[model samples]
Target chain A: MKHIKTLNTRSLQESMKKGGCGECQTSCQ
Target chain B: MVHQYRNNGYNIVLDVDSGSVHVVDDLVYDVIAFLKDDLSKADDAVTARFAGRYSPEEVSEALEEIRALEKNHQLFSRDIYRDAVLDFRNHPTVVKALCLHVAHDCNLACRYCFAQEGEYHGVRALMSYETGKAALDYLVSHSGNRRNLEVDFFGGEPLMNFEVVRKLTAYGRELEKMHDKHFRFTLTTNGVLLDENIMDFCNREMDNVVLSLDGRKEIHDKMRPSRNGKGSYDLIVPKFQKFAKQRKELGKQYYVRGTFTHYNLDFARDVLHFADLGFDQISIEPVVAPADAPYAIRPEDLGTIKEQYDLLAQEMIRREKEGRGFTFFHFMIDLTGGPCVYKRLSGCGSGTEYLAVTPWGDLYPCHQFVGNEEFLLGNVTEGVKRSDLVSIFKSCNVYARKECRDCFARYYCSGGCAANSWNFHQRIDSVYEIGCELERKRVESALMIKAALAD
Candidate 1:
């Protein structure tokens, strides 16, 4: 069960690396 | 003028007009029949010619080509076929096993029972010992060389007629020896009549025993009181606890099932009471009332029952996370993704893959329709052939029903149970009753919620 925490962390890191955190400024005036 | 082309062999009616071809009725059955025939022929050819000539890769490629053909044929309706294939591949046996009502007769009479209604008035009779033996023989012979066999003993109360159960258990052991097969047994009982002798036999022979307990003393007493109007709950509940303890000491697997009717919908809190009694698994089932039973809840009240059941499910899920074993049969759709395949689909080789024999040596589609004349497939004595059983299975296809062809859940739930459909609609293809929708929705919602919570 504790390994699930590591898997989640790895998923989050992969998501961050892939720019899935939505960093594009679409509302720039 | 429109040109209509009907494939009689496939039972598919194709209407081609204006250089466009449109598939009617989803053509599920036609495609299934085609694929089954193609696969069978390919298998036969491979077995005959390539006995030792073809390499493993060649055989795999040949099988893959057949599968691809099935896919191409179902290209227009790919999703349906894909889902069906996934279901089939994941669970080879659409129904893992069956629980049969070998004997309907019971020793004690509970007030809130459905078996006592109408035709069942005479139905509380025992299954002949001959029927029991024939059923075992039918199971062993027809299982298609599948090594493992599973059977569950069910009844108005199974142990009341202990002689038959004991004989069947012993007979099963002998059958296992003769066939060199593994057999597993499970029994569900009311627990009032379960004694030392029964427990000893079960502990040795049976794999698991499920005792029905309905919450605390008062609710159980009021709901399932003995025929004499005495509070049978107090006596039965303690006995259940004692049985669980003895099972633990003797290293036997046992669980308790709590049935919730309209009256005991709020007994979720009392679930822990059974847990405290050292019971491992608690299966909560909603009481099923016969169509004309006086105690039956109205259809409208099913919504309330669902709400109550949802709350219980959440609590049970929490308990499960904490390492306490629990299961609610009502929440089985949640436990197993999608509804029960049997409930969703109408026929899956009923008499072909599974079968039941009545007390008089009459064979039927499963135990539920044993005594009913309509469901009788054939007799064991008169040389029941596989072809006859296949025809019986084919007749249960709900696609023939016009209403079922257009149902929203048609692809998944094939017009509810075959016997129920025939009994109610007088046709297997009619749209299922509202109760079927309500139950499926309830379990589906529960499953969705449970998945979301897990995420």
Candidate 2:
């Protein structure tokens, strides 16, 4: 296993706008 | 021109060109329709239609009212998109995002998965590092001076190709300085393969991470199970909670997205469950399955679905009032800047602003079309063929559909999703009836919430 590294997260406000409908079921689901 | 509908005694008119919505009374409504048909119609013809409803003097006055509406460009307006379409026809299309299907295999066997055992009806495969790199290069070169671009490392399970994802994100970072374009990354996972390293990388470079946990343990385990028939809910919950807390601490965006099927009619419980589990941002959507799929949300489920939406709305409002507000993804209707007609009509960007790449580098309009060759636009090497893309852009928009032209929720819901349209009606432009009803119910719930908030 690779060494686990830490990453920073954007604020919840900034986070809400990301992602796309790259999957099925869940989109309409 | 506009799309108008009579809803509950109110005439809802959506100005197609401007994307403005107007709600008016029966008198104003009938006059607008009459003027829309023929603004030059003599007062007698108007009187003949409404002869018993109103006196001749009233009809004359209504004609004046119609003329006023026309003067304001609210009725009998000229088509605004004709010239705009011609100009765009001469211009080039800019590609902003590529949803790369990095892995076409999954560890879980979700009962309602459209991917067909995670194979997409083809042999399971993982996207090569070279193909992923070329997709980024393709986006940079064809991006047309766009400063911002997006790349979604999507799959039956993106982590199945964890090494490729790690290398791809690193390579994209390296290319950013040289190409002068910013790439926003997102990953959607079922959370079956998330570990310390994968979660770390995802939290670091990935702008968004969609953790698929369908609400409650019982519901999730029942709906989504491992290929070996083992429940995955127990394995994922702790990992997801830890990762989500880290993202929240860093202020990064993430969502716990799940799908509700016919079986989970009380779907709002899923949202409440997320809330109970300390998840603030959530997306609980209805399932999209073949009509005959045993778990499909049937037409009879509409009423309960709607009631559940209302219950969810009430809970959302109560949470906000208590200062513990959480976002239910679908209930998010932009009350400001009504989505433009061109955007609303086309629904999801599909072949226009968005495109999906298969594991082998084949390009389709969106992720849903990866296995379906009929929707193949082109490959990363050749770029999107102009003729093929143009055909999709021209044919897939809501403006091209007849039923959508007069729908009350047309402007808000857009034309609906292309994948759903193709799956339901076998045509890209035709939206599914279930999607339409669900959207209308959501819009209605939103409106109800707005009313309650104002009260």
Candidate 3:
């Protein structure tokens, strides 16, 4: 009956990264 | 695919491929689930399906909203990264990170150490300056246009080879200016030899330092002890507390990393223990060991572990409200600005961009795969000899693993740790089922925390 919010509209894979591992799963064992 | 779940009294719908999350009312939640299952049915059938509970008007409105979201490409979005992933290996392989095991020797004797007390199933040795320099040179040469490079000084304990760590860092800093590249150094230590001098140097140089402390004196001392079987908690706690405070004063980052095994299923208390100790950045992870090992987290522990995650998230929300918020590594998520498609599909870049170098300069995919001779890529001096193996590692993605293909947390974890998969199944493109379950729960708890705090 109701839509509260849309957290993200853009496709996450479409973004660009400048540097750093960017993000690919790490809490470094 | 839409993965719907309720947590912290909120119904969350995650459109897997598109990475879009929708928080909806109960009626809309049911309507979306219905539409996902039978998309061919007309709007009338959808309304009739839920007619008993929700009014026809409510169903109609929910359908309209879903349709609008679909039109806007926010719901039920198609996979656009499939083609990109299929040709993943063809892309240039650039080495950007190195887990330099400076010392294949440890000062502590942790019971569940995967590295076998730091020797990593090999002879105990310290990396010579020449070998460490060669590693830095190899990384720079193979980096291929990546300006920001990460070098984690890992080992049985990096501090055991403090002189070598310092030398390698200085060498890396020198190379950075000449090559127009920046080095981000991280050190993961057991905090056994931590002192004022080392702490000062770490605050000045290391970008991030991971201090190992298993929390709660009883739990920590039992798991992580010295060569003489003496508890290290008494020796390390005061040092860690001072180090954490100094890092905060210098505006640097550090984490008090801990490991919780089956012996302590109530790991949430340990996480709180870190918070109460005035350490802000904390991470208490589930210990990874053979399933038969007494300390290993078994299949039966899944339910209790998930509950602990929920409890931790709720407590995190409470702490934030009380102005005592601290960052829990696993609970952090960047829904809006997450990884790019390349990073998401490829994963942590173990064998490709990131590789591990042993003290004697032997190379492996990562630290976890170091001891396994089968995973040896080559030596740092020779560079990666197994380009075919490198290609295989490069090809590993969410789609490569069958279970990961359908897993809701696939993109979030990027097929989980390849080493973990290889350890269990002898295959990189596989799933660690237990880890998968815990990851899903953590993701849900993270989202719930975000929602609760937003309120």
Candidate 4:
């Protein structure tokens, strides 16, 4: 298995997901 | 669950529970699918499944590699936060950001504006300094232990009440000093009343400025026009360009934000147009409107929209290779450290940790919910009046969202927008399927771009 990126592995309490802030939903707000 | 997909000639496997991403060979990818949730059957499955394709030695090697990753606690990680998330949701949170509607009025009429040209389904008015000051005070007082606070000057046009914005900012600074807090100010403007003084002040005081200009001249003009029925593109574009340039030079953050409606299915061109116009930081998003609206994105447009994202991603990679890469807001993925686990599950602290204050100092869950009276939390002078509403918002998490429970992008989008769900299904816990589809595509495209750049 070739690891690409593992942002968090220590604990689920500190996990960081693979996307940025979905600010797209804040359209014209 | 390990969600695997192929994009741009790369096989990607995402361990949903652990937030681990892997790029593996076709044999390992297929082996993972066969193994599914049972690691005990990995040896038997790998050998039997790939008998005709991969040799015994290659299958054994791939199986060992998979076992090594699993041993490292990177694959098949259990959902440790599943139960804790419920506790996290119930815990009281202090307000960290306020989207202050400084003016419920706008100079230009944006046809797709959710705020109904800034009046928010109410009378057009500017927020008084007293009201803004009270809003700041409320933020400072309620923000326990959190040293940094955010205040966004949002409106039909914040510049209409520019003086109030200036005063509120000054007052916010003073409150920060007194309360030992730091205020990060942001301004979202339509750019009609953006003058030299405003630009200078924003550069000096505002941490980020969001300038609205919807793509090309014709597209933007058709959607955004003045009360006198004149297009606003010619007036706003030059100002926005100048503002963006100065922000770039000063090392401040700003973006030329736009919206894409059904009128522009070829939205990729508009994104390229923004890039060509010399604005590096940009965001062009799908417009959220009622399905019956003439410009609303219909179900049939999904295919075109997803294609646009793919096209935009490919072009962005090309630009990066040419050393002229611009940051697309949605495409930015922080590999080192993204938002914390709580943020990933609970989403943007919309109603709980972040609230929107209207011109009259009344609070709502967020700016999008301003006009809806049922969502009124309370005025600044009086604290959040409806604790029940707060509880309801607190319950909004990825786990609580039925549609998001099985979605692979659930952690990324955090169950999509609550306001949007409420608008569409009248249930905050539901999901907007269209937004979900687009979000998934964007995530895939972003990962593909990352892979290309890494190569």
Native contacts present in each candidate (fraction): 0.00, 0.00, 0.44, 0.24
lDDT tens readout by residue for model 4, B1-455:
67888987888887777767777778888888888767678476669877889888888887778888788767776667766667667666788899999999988888988998889999999999999999999988998887878999999899999999999999988998799988989999989899899999999999999999899999999999898889999998899999999999999999899999999999889999999999999999899899999999999999999889988998999999999999998887665565556677877778888899999999999998998999999999999999899988888888888787777777678778889999999988888888888888888888778777877
Minimal lDDT window, size 10, model 1 chain B: B13-22
Off by over 4 Å in 3: A16-29
Q: Tens digit of lDDT per residue, candidate 3, span B1-455?
A: 78899998989888887788878889888888888876777998887888679899888888899988888767777677777666654678888889999999999999999999999998999999999999999999998887888999999889999998888889999999899998999999988888888988899899999999998999999999898999999899999999999999999999999999999999999999999999999999998888889999999998999999989998999999999999998997788767666666677788888899998898898999998988889998888899889989888877788897777787788778888888899899998889898999988888777677766
Error of 3 at B158 (Å): 0.7
- In candidate 1, residue B200 scores what lDDT? 82
Docking class of 1: incorrect
Q: Clashing pairs in model 4?
A: none
Give lDDT per model, in order.
0.53, 0.74, 0.85, 0.84
Consecutive 10-residue window with the lowest summed lDDT within model 3 chain B? B82-91
Models ranked on DockQ: 3, 4, 2, 1
Could you tell me the TM-score of chain B in model 1? 0.66
TM-score of chain A of 2: 0.27
Ranking according to lDDT, highest score first:
3, 4, 2, 1
What is the TM-score of each predicted model, taking all chains together? Answer: 0.63, 0.79, 0.96, 0.95
Whichever of 1 and 4 has more DockQ, that candidate is 4
Interface C-alpha RMSD, model 1:
25.7
Encode model 1's per-residue lDDT on B13-95: one tens digit a residue.
11110111222222332333344424455545653445565555555454554345335342122123223323432332221
Q: Please report how far candidate 2 places residue B332 from its true position, in Å.
A: 0.9
DockQ scores of all models, one per candidate: 0.01, 0.02, 0.39, 0.21
